[model samples]
Target: MEYQEAKDKFISTWGSLGTLWGINKAMAQIQALLFISTKPLSMEDIMEDLKISRGNTSMNLRQLMDWGIVTKVLVSGERKEFFTTEKDVQELARVIAKERSRREIKPVIKVLDEVSSIKDDGTEKTKELIKQTKALHNLTQDADAMINKLMDQKQNWLTKSVFKLIK
Candidate 1:
């Protein structure tokens, strides 16, 4: 396939994947462009390439920066900023996992804890509620522990090797 067509395909795929992960399509598309480009691109270049307005480009760029996926680069002898993507897939996964844990898992854990703490009455319904809440709390807590362990072991070669062997 032609270079531009291949690039377009990559951008589309990335954008769709981003939507599944709760990120904006434009931001992911921009990041995908930066990831494949040999050199950093200016905001104007991104806007032109993506066919988006300046405001839209700027907003998505800022969001990507906030997510730690993109970084700014100043061109030599030019005031305009360029951008690049974090090419390390492992780091990307680690950041995404950490963010999801904070955003989704932690809040769910709080709710589970609250519900599980409700006074238990003798009614079958109340008993069922207590049972379900307790089970949810245990499952969430286990997941939290697993995430923490994975995050801690992410940089350790032996830990990764062990996991691969077990799997």
Candidate 2:
């Protein structure tokens, strides 16, 4: 396929996969565009290329920045603010994993801990609730801990091995 067709397919596929990462289609599309661009793109450039509204492009860019995946870039001799994303795929994955842990898993873990720590009133239902929640809390905590450990090791041997094994 031609460059245009290949790029379009990649952006579309990435946008569809964005929902799995808890981002909207436009946001993913914007990231995909930025990810493949040879240089930083202006907001207008992104909007035009994606055929999205100005507001949509702006909002999604802000969200992507919040997620630590995208950043505002300064263009020499250009007034328009430009944007770029993490170019290294491994680094990008690490950032997204860390952010997701903080934003999503951490909150759920907190709630689970709170629910599981409630006083045991000797009632069967209360005991069952505590038991179940504690189990879930422990499991979630372990998973999160593992994820954090993996993310902390930047391009470590183990991480590289794991990725290789997965592939």
Clashing pairs in 1: none
The TM-score of predicted model 1 comes to: 0.88
Model 2 deviation from the true structure expressed as Cα RMSD, one decimal place = 2.2
Tens digits of per-residue lDDT for model 1, 15-46: 98986767889988998899898999999999
Whole-model lDDT per candidate: 0.86, 0.92
Q: Give the number of the best model, judged by TM-score.
A: 2
| Global Cα RMSD, each model | 2.2, 2.2
lDDT of 2: 0.92
Residues 18-121 of candidate 2: C-alpha lDDT, one tens digit per residue? 97888899999999999999999999999899999999998999999999899998999999999999998878888888888989999999999999999999
* Weakest ten-residue segment in model 2 by summed lDDT: 151-160
Q: Candidate 1: how many backbone clashes? A: 0
Against the hidden reference, what TM-scores do the models get?
0.88, 0.92
Tell how far residue 123 is off in model 2, in angstroms: 2.2
